[model samples]
Target: MKRNFLLLLIFVLVVIAISEGIGFQSIPIGKFNIGLLPLVFAIIITMVLGIRIFRKGIIKKIYSKENVNFASKYLIFIMLPLMARYGADVAPKLKEILSIGWVFLIQEVGNLGTVVLGLPIALLIGLRREAIGATLGIGREGELAYISEKYTLESPEGRGVLSLYIIGTLFGAIFFSIFAPVLLDLGFRVEALAMASGVGSGSMMTAASSTLVARMPELGETIRAYASASQLLTSFLGTFTMVFLAAPLQKFMYGLFIRGEK
Candidate 1:
């Protein structure tokens, strides 16, 4: 009940932020913005775990198989980028279907850029291949829900998962922000490639990426238009990919690692 309340509160706060246009415009700390929404969500999740730990004392017995399962699912944090890329790729179909026209493409390209920058890092970190599909939300929703119900991660365990996600996402972002310029200087920049492949199912990230890319001069005026075009393309296909692929991938991973465990 308490956990549910916490989540509800966080949802309310997010709604308020959206309605009021409150955003991460102010930098409170280095590399960490004073965005109320993301921070609130992160805090609420942590609070749930803290409360759980306080209520139920620690258990010493280790279930290595279960731990592996948790760890593998924990890797779904990588979806942060995949979602962006997917959103980028599906935007065009959205424009045609909704008649929103050509303006939505910027968001898509930036989203793809973010994905290209982030997914490779996730792969490098030894994330399970099946886990990657889930992170991208590729046919994984029902499976994730099922896994969440059957293999409950207590608050303490959940805290670890959230932390892994936060760390992984931040590292991926920071690496991209810092290294992208260096790569550009070496004439090896792949911003367009990133823009093409990175945007996934997350519209918000795609929009954010579009805004960021628009500020870069090297992307060219035509490129800005293309980014918007790409976002439109991503929004349509990405959603379908998520519906079809997420579950089977998770099951495949389970078979590979947590075989026959209850």
Candidate 2:
């Protein structure tokens, strides 16, 4: 129990720091680029605390049924908006909110939203259920590819899910492209604004903006920074969002697709 509380605190602190526009360079870990020193410190704190808690058998306690239920409710309230914001960003209204400095809070929540919202969306769009098996990067790419191939369903169902992913990605791309100008107009350093918003969108917006930056080298660092931060935020936020929404989404599934059958 203590471990979970401490870990959550550390994560919240990191979120606060990222929101406040603080970051630093660090050693890379394979495919992942490490963030600022404070991030490193926070990670270390989490690791140390987690190890300590493990020795005390607190994890089991934290995962007890009652605690899990409480955590689930909290996750629903916090994570739903996060993902909703992420999926709906292809417009000006969201950008306007960022310009006023709501980016930090929204971005913080967004890191948790993708999974909360992404998985349910994936299920509804009919991605063969196997694609989501790879959602957490828990298994190998070959496994997901194999599952998708073996469970190939009707062409129409495949197309439908693909269409949903397409729409989601399009919204992410358009939101960043349109918002870039707004940030520039607001006198925010292009890279900073990009970094902030990209994190919120799970780096899906990075390619769109990076292409734009490629045409203008002056924006390279900003684009790189945005991509880096966004990717990290996405991994962490997306996973937590999934954990948070799992229960609620399960209930939703019966209502939307399995009504009266079960």
Candidate 3:
């Protein structure tokens, strides 16, 4: 455990060093600037290292499978409380969401847009059970839990969702950082974008909100408040949608459009 903690600390410091080192280089899209290449590069490097370790059997020699599994499980124990704190931070500012009126409320409903958008695309692409799970699931812990409970992680569905969750965790922030600024340049209101950023993932919300706040410093607090409220709504309601609506809806869509039901 001490070794694992030391490794984790070293890993974080390396990532931070890389992020700062590469902070100056950025990709510019029109008037908007998309930085954070260092962060992205760090993530890719970590992924490549992990893949090499696992595929080359280096991981087994260096670390016991049980210890690795223990780290993976307990890491979530650390993350979940931080996430809940993010949700808790929204409590005082939640009424601000109401001030934005029904448009914010309506956008909250569109939090399920993943299932709506992804299922069709997955079907069109002729994805099967496991791929369907990745497509329909929002790629969060709640969705992961539901899928794991119903279908073990070794199942195709579980693998699908887990893969999506991994991808989402690694790149979702960078994508949102770029995408949010582009949307703003396209003339979307900050309120709408703030609410949109709250799609239940704290990493995503942080990325989007931070980018927007950097761009428009005057609206930083408002943007954060709206984002927090929207995120809270997503986290709260996303649970119900994943368990009751998303899974069933995906199955129904597959049965209706595709040939097999598994």
Predicted structure with the largest lDDT when compared to the true one: 3
Q: Predicted candidate 1: what Cα RMSD to the true structure?
A: 11.7
* Cα error of candidate 2 at position 199, Å: 6.0
> What TM-score does each of the candidates earn?
0.36, 0.33, 0.81
What global local distance difference test value does model 2 have?
Answer: 0.45
Clashes of 3: 0
Candidate 2 per-residue C-alpha lDDT over 27-135 given as tens digits, one digit per residue, 9 for 90 to 100: 3455433233332333334345445456345544544555556663575466556445444432333344346444443455544343355556665776544333323
Q: What C-alpha lDDT does candidate 1 achieve relative to the native structure?
A: 0.40
Worst 10 residues of 1 by lDDT: 55-64
lDDT of 3 by residue, 1-262 (tens): 6665566557667777977676634468668667454555666666666664463453333344655576667776766776776666566666775666566556655755677788778767766777666866568878788778888899988888899998898788778888888888889998789888988787788778877887788987778878888787777877876667776777777788776555
Candidates in order have lDDT scores of 0.40, 0.45, 0.73
Q: Who wins the TM-score comparison?
A: 3
Ranking by lDDT: 3, 2, 1
Clashes in model 3: which pairs?
none
lDDT winner between 1 and 3, please give it: 3
Backbone clash numbers for all candidates listed: 45, 5, 0
